[model samples]
Target: MDVILFRFGNFPVTVLEAGLALGLFVVVAISVLLIVVLRQSRSRADAEIRASEHTHELEERISELLRTQSEMTGRMQTMAEVFGSRQSDMMRAVNERLDGMGQKLGQTMTDTTKHTNDGLRQLHERLAVIDRAQRTITDLSGQVVELQTILANKQTRGAFGQGRMEAIIQDALPATAFSFQQTLSTGVRPDCVVHLPNGAPPLVIDAKFPLEGYNLIRNAERPEEAKQAQAQFRRDVGKHVQDIRERYLIPGETQDTAFLFVPSESVFAEIHENFEDIIQKAHRARVVFVSPSLLLLSIQVVQSLLKDARMREQAHLIQAEVGKLMDDVNRLDERVRKLQTHFGQTSKDIDQILISTDKITKRGRNIEELDLGSLEELPSSERGNNQPTLLNPALKSVPAGE
Candidate 1:
């Protein structure tokens, strides 16, 4: 296959030379390819070796991680157990504390309930008492209103005073000791007349009061009006005192001093305080202004005097009873002396009987030791004299051998 392809510049080229050149290029390409394959193979081998070493290291790390994870798991389990036990203990303690607190709360609530009930009961009782007190206050208010109504009317007010005086005298003195609305010797009727004991004149009590002028004095606001009202009150009271003295007093039938009974203590006090001249004039006229309390005191004195008089009248009866008691005591003493004499005679009789018993006892002893032969040895006169006076009839029939 030698053929001429091209000519070199200085030499002619043959087909054999072109063929050898191509063959040489092919050889060089083959060598280069072999070199490249060998280098790639060695690099691959080294990479495989490195990959195996890394895999071994990774396996070792995974095993170590597994061991550490197991240890952590065990520690976690231990911690869980410890926490569970602690939780159980805490739970038990909390339960116990809760139970105790519950009991205490229950007991406290019960005690509070009991105290609430007791307090409510006491409050109800107090309310009831307050209700009763309210009722009493209402009654008292009604009575006060009624009294005011009575005092507003002159006749009723006088009747009220007379009634009060009558009640006082009737309560303190017997019906015989006092008389109500009694006509005096002068033909004037007094509210009360108290008969004193032992020939003393009767005491007069007049219950007519001059309340209008006193009410005027109390109601006057201006000083000038008050002065006029006080003067009027003084005149009214002085006139009342004079009327009582003239109407009730008598020389021998009634006491020289007569009581002008004022129903109210306040009215009497007002008269004495604001009208001193009235009191002086009243005293000089043998007239006495007496309030309810003063009248009661005088009545009590009269009662005591009556009591003393009754006691004096009963003194002789008591003396007569004492004389009869002395006579009974003398009779008792004489009877006791007779009983003592009888007791002494009985004692002497008992002594003689005891002496006879001693002699009988001596005779019984002699009879007990006596033989039939000894009985025959005794004289008949001595035997008859020696026989016991107190021997039983059955013993008298007993044989000497027995």
Candidate 2:
């Protein structure tokens, strides 16, 4: 068993070499471990500085993105304002055009209404005038009907008959060529007298209208009354014929046949049909029953005769005037012959005077050879004053000129 111990210079000394060497080795390992820990701590501090620099770079990029977004929002706001202003101007122009069109439409509608109203007013006025004219025509028609009624009665029928007869006579002959109610020397007055030409006596025409009994017969109700009235009418016709024969048929005083005028055609036909014997009696009595148609024929015949007589008289007067005109023309021809004879004689006398003047003018051309200085004689008045001339020659035979 060996044991080791060390001893230092202090109090006790022992020798232990192995244990001392182990202690020295442990001190050296502890120093190397402390140096390695210091180097690891320095490397941790360098890594922390690099991480802080990276964090600062990220913050700068975020701030630049925010600035770009703000500039874009400002430009969009300016574009919106310009578009709103242009839209307002377009809306104002459209409103002004619509107002002008509305005014023109209103004026046109008002003018059309006024023209239609005026046309209707004129039509109403024309209708009123037509209505007034129709009323006037209706009133005139009523008056004409009343007047016709008054002219068809019995008591006033005589005046109407006279007027109708006068119209018929006037129509047959001109009233200016005829005289009515002319009285003759026999105290008989005729109804009409027609004057003729060439100093012929006027023709006498009597108007006798017998219509009383005829009217009674026309108005009879029963057949027996009609027969009785017809019989009375026959007697009345006969009496009227007799009366006309006595009043107007004066031989040599008036015409041979007297005119008995029946104004109505129906009355004349009745008298001829039922009273033929009365007409024969009238013919025997020199009374001619003349209807309006027959009277017109007779008047026309008389007028024709008068016209022929007038034409004949005019022809005679024209012949006499033609004979007188022929005499005047013969006298005018004789005066023209005498004037031509006087013109021939005057021409012969003028020719003889011209020949005598020519002979005198030729003899005067030789006056210078006849001693013209001594040929100057005294004046004729001095010679007459010197000698008294004999006032008268001896009155031989005593002719009238002498």
Runs of candidate 2 with Cα error greater than 4 angstroms are 1-158, 171-177, 185-188, 195-203, 342-402
Clashing pairs in 1: none
The C-alpha stretches of model 1 lying farther than 4 A from their native spots are 1-61, 316-402
80-179 per-residue lDDT for model 1 (tens digits): 5666687788889999999999999999999999999999999999999999999999999999999988998999999999999988888788888998
lDDT of each: 0.82, 0.65
Q: Model 2 — which ten-residue stretch has the worst lDDT? A: 389-398
Cα lDDT tens digits, model 2, 1-402, are: 012234456644222233334445644554454454445545667755443443344234334433433443344344434445555666677777777778888888888888888988888898889889889888988976754453345445545555565676688666666777778777877777766555655666555565667767878999999988878877877887777777766666566667776666777787788778878998898877777788778778877877787789799899999999999999999999999999999999999999878756655553322432221264566465745432233222234331
Q: Which candidate achieves the best TM-score against the true structure? A: 1
Model 2 lDDT on a 0 to 1 scale:
0.65
Flag clash pairs in model 2: 5-14, 5-15, 5-16, 6-14, 6-15, 6-16, 7-14
